[model samples]
Target: MQLGLLYSGGKDSTLAALVLERFYDITLVTAHFGVTDEYEHARQAADAAGFEFRALELDREVAEEAVERMREDGYPRNGIQHVHEAALEAVADLDFDAIADGTRRDDRVPTVSRAQAQSLEDRHGVDYLSPLVGFGRNAVDRIVDAELDVEVGPSEEIPRADYEAELRAVLAEEHGEGAIREVFPDHDQTYVHGLRE
Candidate 1:
């Protein structure tokens, strides 16, 4: 089966692609609001993982809507979910047998709920899978450590394919740094430094 894997050029997504490669034809897909250097990074990561790579440009309006939703909700959980759903919806038009993401057991945001997953399969006829859903941080870390060479740092410090990165930049530029700080809040943002060895 051809699997469209939502990639972020991070350990989680890269590892997920590797795991699924055994059973499916993996195509790494990265979504961005506009032109970004992150796409190049994602391409390199996909090359390292030995998978085909594609970057999909998401509508800027979606990012705006997500920011607005975050402003209204007073948190980023809903906004992040909105972006994720938008990305998935954007990719749904492609001719892929199934869609997958790197959401782990511990992931709280950017994850499809059971209802949402069912809706995708039922309405869109696309199966949504999260290969790392059953794996915890420790197990995931061990696997990546053993199989991949990665550099980890705060989300801000690392350059990778992250939906929130563009959204945050736009929000900060249009609104202010305070807007980003308020919406995203203080959190641990970790990202993979580069392609796995």
Candidate 2:
């Protein structure tokens, strides 16, 4: 079956791709709001990972709304969660049998509840999969170490194609760079280089 995986060029997403590699024809897709060219980074990672790649355009209004919500909330969890749901819905609209993401069991945000997953599947007529949802950080890290090469650093330093990047750009453009720092705390981000040889 054909599957579209929401990819961010990060370890979790990349590892999710690897886990699903044998079961489906996977296309690594990056959802972007057209606010920046960061999607190109995901494209490169897809190439290195040897998967078909596509940049799916998301509604810019969603980004705008998410940024506004983040600004008001003074944190990114809700806004980021909103974008992630939108992204999953967007991916479900594609002509694939399944849609997947890298959200894990332990993640504090961006999680899809069982009801939400069922709703997505029921509405879209496609299975929604999250390959890493059952795995903890240690298990995921061990698999990533065995299967992929990654670059890890502070969030701003890492080149990535995820909601956070576009959100930061939008937040910065409208509010200011300081607003970005205010909304998003400093955390490590990862960029996958490729699978191990």
- Residue 166 of model 2: what lDDT? 96
- Model 1 C-alpha lDDT per residue in residues 1-197, reported as the tens digit of each score: 99899998888998898789889998999999884566777887777667899999989899889888888987888888889998888777688999999999998887778898899878778988989999999999899888877867666777678787888887887789889878876545445544445
Candidate 2 per-residue lDDT, tens place, 1-197, comes to 99999999999999999889999999999999999999999999999999999999999999999999999999999999999999999999999999999999899989999999999999999999998999998999888989999999999999999899999999999988899988999899999999999
lDDT (Cα) of model 1:
0.83
* Per-candidate TM-score against the hidden true structure: 0.91, 0.98
Best model per lDDT: 2
The global C-alpha lDDT for each of the candidates, from Candidate 1 onward, is 0.83, 0.94
Please list the Cα RMSD from the true structure of every candidate, rounded to 1 decimal place. Answer: 1.9, 0.7
